[model samples]
Target: METKVAIVTGGNRGIGFEIVKGLCQKFDGVVYLTARNEERGQQAVKKLEELGLKPLFHILDVTCEKSIEDLAKHISTHHSGIDVLVNNAGILDFDKAISSYEDAKKLIDTNFTSLLTISRILYPLLTNTARIINISSDWGLLSNIRKQVWLDRLVKDDLTVEQILEFVNEFLNAAKMGKSAFFSIAGKYGDYKVSKVAMSALTFVQQRQFREEGKDISINCVHPGFVMTDMTKGMGDFTPERGAKAPLYLALEAPQSLKGSFIWHDCHHVNWDD
Candidate 1:
């Protein structure tokens, strides 16, 4: 039998760490916990080891294509391919008063663009029944925009990946020109929200591509609820373990028939049209 393997990016802490632990306990194969920092990543693995759960460690910086490519080559060489992938890596710059174009680019690149890059690289290595979960936020909902015109464009089923990239680029460019508030819906956390919206859009596009290619892969995105993490300054109603539940479900138990859907943390289908 072939060795089954799973990879969880940004798994050194918080929800990602919990997801790695869940996979280590439940998955019948090896689980790799990836972090950008080697010391932190190895420490996370050591903590899991204390629990008798063996999770390997890898250094991954989603913002760098070289880092993503290196991890892909390592996995392909060692495990033949990947059975599960949880794209838990993401960022949220909470400085509402800071609106630098460079920061905006970083936010979108880490949260949205880099995901597409990694997915593109690792997709070919996915097995027949593989599952891919993209961790998203409810803030990406169409309702957040408040403008019917922009909301319609985003929720439209026919929206293409190229169009989504164009949309994000437009926002970033506008921000660079000192018009960060140019969009009606972006408000303060414009960069973070726009990045997640693009991620949601990418989920739909990839799902359609997979179907067109006749693959049995399951790909979905979910809002992991507002959890207590460093990103939230440790202020949230839910724990990190609770936040991991939704992504873990989408990665493992979700039916193949449930592809391309945006799911709430409670595991219900979200009405993107609303």
Candidate 2:
């Protein structure tokens, strides 16, 4: 039998770190904890090692194509294929000190676009029954998209990834042009919310594509809830450990029928269109 391998991007800290720890303890395979910074990734692995839970570390800067390719190449060379992938690397609007347009671009690229790029790059390396869990947010729900037309387009069962990409590009263009109307449509944390909305939508798109391609891979997006992390400025209803529960469940335990769904931190299925 081939060795099962799992990877968690942005796994050096916060909920990502907690998920890595959980996988190290429960997953029946090698768990890799990936992060953008080599030092931080190694440090996180050491922390888990001290806890007597072994998790391998790798450098993964989600926004960088070269970095993602390197990780993909490493995985292809060392393992049979990826059994599980947790797309958890992301950023909040306040995490950077750039202009609004630049900030919005970076946020959208990191939180949303990187998911597409990394998945596409790693798609060939996924095992037949692989599971992909995208870390989305409640803000990603279509309800956050106050515009009905936008909601209608995204809620379509036959929604294509191209449509989702176009929607994201439209939002970025609006942000660049200072269109307050677009901001009003997305409401608070506009850029972040839009990016996650795109991520959740992409989940459905990928699942449909996999099904059409005759692959057994299952993909789902999750709203990990407002966990107390640097992203939330440490103000939230749950801790990192609590936040890790649902994602960990999906990664290691959820039934394959759970694909293309938006899940809550408690593992409840949520209607993404609502």
Candidate 3:
């Protein structure tokens, strides 16, 4: 029997690294630890090897259309069909205000838009009932999350991907005019929170689209709890390994009917309305 295959974008560091490790341990298949930098990608593979795990490095820069296309071609030619795609590659930038249009645009490209690009390019390589998991954040909640304040107003239902993009761009435009960080860009810096919100919404829309088309593929979005990693400066309540748990659960354990939903760590269902 042919082994299964998975592609993890931005798997070089932080939570992406932990996700790669978890997938390798739990799934019997090839896990492509994709990174834009060739050296970093290899380094991650080396680290995984030291742990007696098999991880192959595939250089991928999700923002580049050609790069995604090339990876799709490469994967199609070299391995078995892809069984799972973890859209983990993204960025977080902070400015005094969202008026930094250049920086804000970059965040949108990587965090929200690039996912659609990667999925489009790689969709061809996916086998029957493939899974696509978008890594989202709780900050994307509609309610403000300052420090440890839990937001209870994130509307996860009734959001389509197009609506989310519009929201992100609107925030960018609003931030340009100093209209409230497009949803709390003041504290955390950059468009991090807004971008996550857009991605989560997009995940729902993509799932709905797939279902409408009668495809059996499972598509969903999830937020990993605060975990210690380079991104969180190792200060989160959970370790990178622990933070990776929810994504791992979604990728390998979640049921098919649960597809196209916004979920929290460990595959817990989330109320988009909150």
Q: Name the best candidate (by TM-score).
A: 2
Better of 2 and 3 by TM-score: 2
Best by lDDT: 2
Q: Model 3 lDDT vs. the true structure?
A: 0.76
lDDT of 1 by residue, 101-209 (tens): 8888887888899987897888889998888898988877766665456676876778888888877887787777775444544767878888888888888888888
lDDT of 3 by residue, 1-274 (tens): 8778998999999889999999999877889899999998999999999999998888999899999998988887887689989998877632244436677778778888898787678886887788888888777554433422223223444555565566666667755765454445434454777777667767777777777878888888887887767666456788778778888988888887778677877668876545
Candidates by lDDT, descending order = 2, 1, 3
Order of candidate numbers by TM-score, starting with the best: 2, 1, 3
Model 1 error, position 220 (Å):
0.7
Candidate 2 — which residues are off by over 4 angstroms?
94-99
Each model's lDDT comes to 0.85, 0.89, 0.76
TM-score of each: 0.95, 0.96, 0.87
Candidate 1, residue 250: lDDT: 84
Model 3: worst 10 consecutive residues (lDDT sum): 145-154
Span of ten consecutive residues with least summed lDDT in model 1: 179-188
